[model samples]
Target: MVERVVATEEAIQLINKLKSIHGPLMFHQSGGCCDGSSPMCYQEGELKVGASDVLLGHIGGSPFYIAADQYAYWKHTQLIIDVVNGRGGMFSLEGPEGKRFLTRSRVFTEEERKELQL
Candidate 1:
C-alpha cells in the first residue's frame, strides 16, 4: 500500500530520540502564516485531533495529521518528513532540541495515486 507520509533515516533517528525523552510523539502539519508547512512534533495527544484533522499516516511510528482543509491541498502528494538543523514552532517539542522537522513532498504518479485511491 502507498503511504501518504514517511520519514527519512535522519528523521527517524531524531524521532526515536525524542520519543525516548518525551515518550510517544505525533506530528501535525502546520498550515501557513507562521511555520508554513513545518511539521510540528508533540507528545502523543498533546494536541487534540478530531474530524477536522486528517490522518495522513505515520512516520517513525508516530501518527501524522494535517487539517482536513489542508489535506485538500495535499491529498495528491506524499509528505516526506525530514530532520534539519533549526528551531521549529514554539509549541513543538523539537523546538528546544536544536532540530526541526521539515515537510517535503512530491506529487504522486498516476500509478501511485491510483494505488492510494487518490
Candidate 2:
C-alpha cells in the first residue's frame, strides 16, 4: 500500500521532540487564509475532526488529515511534510519551536495512481 503523506527525517525528528513534550500528536491540512494551509500539528484530539475531515494517512506515528474539500484538491499528489526555519501557523504547535512544518507535493505517476486506484 502507498502512503499519501510522509515526513522527512528532519521533520520526524522535530515531531519526536514535540511528542516528547506534548505526548501524541496529529496533523491537519486546511485552506484557511494565512498559513492555515500549512500542516498544523496538534496534540491528538486538541482539535476536533468532524465529518468534513478526511484521513490522508500518518506521519511519525501520528494521523494526518485534511478537510474533505481540501483533500479533493490534493488527492492527486503525495504530500511531503518537511520542517523549515521560521514560524509555523499561528495556531500550529510548531510555531514556538522556531521551525515550521512545510508541505511539499509531487504528482502521482501513472503507475502510482493506478496502484492507489486514483
Candidate 3:
C-alpha cells in the first residue's frame, strides 16, 4: 500500500537519534502561527490527540497526525516529512537538536487515490 506520510533518509536518521534520547515519539503538523506548518515531534504521550485530530500515517515508526480542520485542506496530498537545518517547534524534541522537521507534499496520483479509495 502507498503511504500517506513518509520520511526522507536524513529525517529517518534524525528520528532515530531523537528516539535514542526521548524513547518513542509522535508527530503532529502544526496548523500555522508560531510553528507555521512545521512538523512537531513529541515523546509518545507527551501530547494528547483528540477527536479533532486525524492520523495521516507513520514516519520512522512514529504516528503522525494533523488537526482535522487542517486535514480537510490537505487530504488530497501526501505528507513527506524531511529534516532541515534550523530550529523546530519550541516544545518539539528536535528543537534543541539543531534540526527541524519540515513537511513536503505531492498531489496523490490517480492510482494511489484509487488504492486509498479517496
Candidate 4:
C-alpha cells in the first residue's frame, strides 16, 4: 500500500527524540502564513483535529494530518517530512532544538494516483 505521508530517517530520528521527551506526538500541516505553512508537531491532543482535517498517514507512529482545505491544494502529491537545521514553526516542538521539521513533496505518478484512488 502507498502511504500519503512518510518521513526520512533523519526526521524519524527527530521524531523519536521529541517523543522521548514529549510522549505521544502528532503532526499537522499548516495552511499558510505564520505557523500555518509548515508542519507542526504537537503532543497528541495538544492540537485538535476537527472534521476539516484529513489524516494523511502515520510517520514514526505519529498521526499526520492536513487541513481539508489545504489537502485540496496538495492532493496530487505525497508529503515527505524531513528535518533541517533551523528553527521550525514558532510553536512547533522542534523549534527549541535548533532544528525544524520540513515538508517536501513529489507529484504522484499516474500509477500511484490511480492506486490511491486520487
Candidate models: Cα lDDT each? 0.89, 0.93, 0.90, 0.93
**Residue 57 displacement in candidate 1 (angstroms):** 0.5
lDDT of 3 by residue, 1-118 (tens): 9888999999999999999999999999858888856899999989889889999999999999899888888888899999999888888899888999989999999999999888
Of 1 and 4, which scores higher on TM-score? Answer: 4
- Model 3, TM vs. native: 0.95
Cα-based TM-score, every candidate: 0.95, 0.97, 0.95, 0.97
lDDT of 1 by residue, 89-113 (tens): 8888888889988888999999998
Name model 4 segments beyond 4 Å from true: none
State the lDDT of candidate 4 residue by residue for 45-116, as single tens digits.
999899999999999999999999999999999999999998889889999999998889999999999998
Q: What would you estimate as the lDDT of candidate 4?
A: 0.93
Candidate RMSDs in Å, in order, are 1.1, 0.8, 1.0, 0.7
Badly placed stretches (over 4 Å) of model 2 are: none
| Clashing pairs counted in every model | 0, 0, 0, 1
The lowest-lDDT stretch of 10 consecutive residues in candidate 3 is: 29-38
lDDT of model 1 at residue 95? 81
Error of 4 at 111 (Å): 0.7
Which regions of candidate 3 are displaced past 4 Å?
A: none
In TM-score terms, which candidate is top? 4
